[model samples]
Target: MSSIRLIVSDLDGTLLSEDNRLNDSVIDAVRRFRASGGLFTIATGRFGPSARPIVDRLDIDIPYILCNGCVIADRDKIWEMAQLTLEEIAPFLREADQAGVTVLLFGEDGIRTLRSTPETAYFEQREGLPCVPLNPGDEAWTERPVQKVVLIGDMSQIRPLWDRCRSGYAREYAAVQSEDHFFEIIPARQSKGEALKKLMAHLGVAPSEVMSIGNQLNDLEMIEEAGIGVAVANSHDELIRHASYVCRNGYGEGVVEAMERFAAIGAGSKGGNTYVD
Candidate 1:
C-alpha cells in the first residue's frame, strides 16, 4: 500500500489550467486517489466562495485550506479560521486606495471592495464571485472578520506594495506574491503549511503520509511541510528549489504525474529523472 494518506494541491496554477478549469484526466486521478482511501484537498489564495465550485466538482469531503491558509473548511463546517480586524488591515487598504491599486478583502461572509476596477471585474468574472461594495461607515461591514487582503495591480504597482509590507509588516503579517499581479496579506504566522499541519492533526495523519503540489511562491510553505513536495514544470524557481520532486509536466498534467508516482496504489519507481535538490 502507498504511504501517502493525503494529497493537497494548489488551485490556480497547479491543479487548474490557465482558463481555470480542471482537465478530465486530473478529475479522474483525484477520484481514483479517493477511491483508494487516500484523502485529498486544496490549499489556495482564493476565498471559500470562489473555491467552492472546484471543491464540489472534485467531490472533496475533507477540509480545504483557503486564503493562503487563513481559513480551513469543508462543505458544511469551518474547522479553523485566522482573521484580521479592520484596524489591522486598514492601513494597507488606505494605501492601496490612494495608490490606485485594487484592494479586495476576503471576509467570512464574502468578498468586498471599496471600489471596483477593470481588474476587479476580471477577477470577479474569473472567480465567479462578485465583489460587494464595502460600506466604510457601516458598523456591520467594519466589524466583519476579514480573512485576508489582496492587492491587484501590475508588477510596478505591486512591487512597491510588496516591499513596503515586507519591510514594515513582516512581523505582523505574511505578505506573499501569489501572482505577478497579486500581493496577498494575511495574519502573521499563518500559512498553508501551518494549516496543513492543523489538518493533518485533525485527520490523525502523519507528515510523512502527505504529499503537496503547487506552482507559486505562496505555496512554498505547504510544499516544504509535506513529506513529498512536488513543483510543476512551470513553477516559480523558488518553489522548484524547495520541492523534492519537480514534474516534467505543468498544471493538471503535473498533478496527475505526481499522483501516479507517489500516491497511487502499488506505485513504484521514480518513473524518470523528476527529482532535484
Candidate 2:
C-alpha cells in the first residue's frame, strides 16, 4: 500500500454530522474511496469500542488511530498502545477532583470513574460504555496503567484545571482540548501525527502520500504533518490558519466535500469548493 493514497479523518465535527451521526453519503464515499484503491481510516480521540462501530459500519480494512493516537487498532487487534501509570494519574485525579472536574479513565478495562456525573452520563450515552465506579482510593487503578485520562464537564470546571495541567505537568503529559469541555491527557510523546507516522512506517507509506482532516486542537499536529491537511468550515480558527485547504461544508458534508476534492485532485483538477490556506 506504499503507492496507495492514505486518508485519515477525524470522527466528530469532521466525519460525523453536527448531530453526531454518520450520514449515508459519507458511508458511500468511504466505500467508493476504498474501492478505488485508497486506504481510508479515522484518527479520533475515541477509544476502540467507541470508534469500532463506525469502522465496522464502513468496513474499513486499515488500522485506525484511537484515543487521541495513544492507541492504533484494526477490527481484529490493537497494533500499538501508549500507556500511563496510576502513579502518574494520581496527581491528575487528585487535582481534577479538587478542581471539581469530572475525569474519565480509559484502560484495557474500559472507562472507570469515581462516580457518574452528567458529563460522564453524556460520555456513556455517546461511547456506549458504562463508567465502572472506581474512586480515587480504589485498588483497581493501582496495579494497571491506563491508555488515557480524559476530563469532561463544563468549561468553568475544566479550564483552570487544563491551564494548571499545561503549566505544571508539561514535561510528563500532553494535554489537548479535543472539545471545549473535553481535555485529554496522554503521554508527552503521543499524538495523531506521531501515530500516523508509525502507521506509515508499518505500511511503507510516506507523509507525502497521506491526507488527513480534522477540526480541533487534538488534530492540529496531524493536520500540519499530512501532505494534504484539511479543515472544515466550522473548524477552530487556529486550525484553519494552518490547514492546506479549507472545505466549503462542515461536518459530514465536509467529509464528502473533502473526498470529492481528493477525487478532483487525483484527476488533475483543483476545484473551487476547497480553498488554499
Candidate 3:
C-alpha cells in the first residue's frame, strides 16, 4: 500500500497542454483521484484572476495554492496569504521599469499593469481574465501595494532584468520563471513547499504521504519537498534529476504513468474515466 494521500501540480507548462489548454485526460485524472479518497491541488504562480478558469474546469472542491504559494484558497476560506510589502514592491517595480520590463501587478481584486499594451491584452485574452490597465501618468496605479507582480516578456530580454535585480536584491523577493516567456515575483518567505506543508497540516496528513508533479523551475521547491516527486518527460532537467521517479510520457499521460507506476492510483477510482498510460 502506498502512503500518498495528496497530489499537487503546477499549471501553464506543467499541466496545461502545449497550446495552453487543459485536456480531458488531466481533468479525468483529477476527478478520479479525488474520488479515490485522495486530495488534489494546483500550485502555480498564477493569481486568482488567471488561475480561476482552470479551477472552475476541475469542478471539484479542493484548495488552490496560488501566487507561487503566497496565497492559499480553500474554496471560500483563505488559509494563507503573504503580500509583498509596499516598500519591496515599489523599488522592485522601479528597477524592472528601469530595466525595460513590463510589470503586471496582481491583487486580491484583480490584475493591474504598469502600462497597457498589446502584450498584456494578449495575456488577458489567453487566460480569459480582465486586466485593469494602468496609465503611466497615474502615479497611484504605479504605487499601489500588491500581492504579486508578473513580468511578461521574452526570456532573453527578461533574463538580463532578472539578473540585475537578483544581483542587488537577493532573497528580497522570490523571483521565479513560471514559463519561458514570463517571470513572477513574490514575497521571499512564501513558496509552494511552505503552502503544501500548511495544507498537509490542515488536512492532518504527513509530508511523507504527499506526491507532487511539476515541470518548471517554480515547481522545483514543491517537487523537492514532496516525499514522492514525480517529474514528467517534459520536466526541466534539474527537476527531472531531483524527482524520485521520472514518468516516461509527458503531460497528462505522464501523470497517469506516475500514479500507476507508484501503485497509488487504480481503476474505478472516480468519474467515468480511469487513467491508463
- Top-TM-score structure, candidate number: 1
Question: Model 1, which residues run further than 4 Å from truth?
Answer: 135-143, 165-171, 265-277
The reply for model 3, stretches above 4 Å from the true place, is: 86-95, 98-100, 166-171, 267-277
Q: What's the CA error at residue 52 for candidate 1, in Å?
A: 1.2
Residue 166 CA error for candidate 2 (Å)?
Answer: 6.1
* TM-score of model number 3: 0.87
Q: In model 3, how large is the Cα lDDT of residue 176?
A: 81
What's every prediction's RMSD, in angstroms?
5.5, 5.5, 3.8
Q: Which has the better TM-score: candidate 1, or candidate 2?
A: 1
Residue 264 lDDT in candidate 2: 38
lDDT of 3: 0.76
- How well does candidate 3 match the true structure, expressed as C-alpha RMSD? 3.8
Residue lDDT tens for model 1, 2-120: 89999999999899876677777787788888989999999999987788888988899989999999889999988888888666456667777778899888887788987878988
Ten residues in sequence with the least summed lDDT for candidate 2: 268-277
Each prediction's TM-score against the native? 0.88, 0.88, 0.87
lDDT of 3 by residue, 1-277 (tens): 7677888888766677666767676777777777778888888888876777777778647788998899999657777788875443566576766666777888888887766767788887777777777766666764456778788777787777667656765347777877767788788878888888888888887878888888878888898888888888888888888888888888766776676665356642333332111
Tell me how far the alpha carbon of residue 264 in candidate 2 is from the true structure, in angstroms, after superposition: 3.6
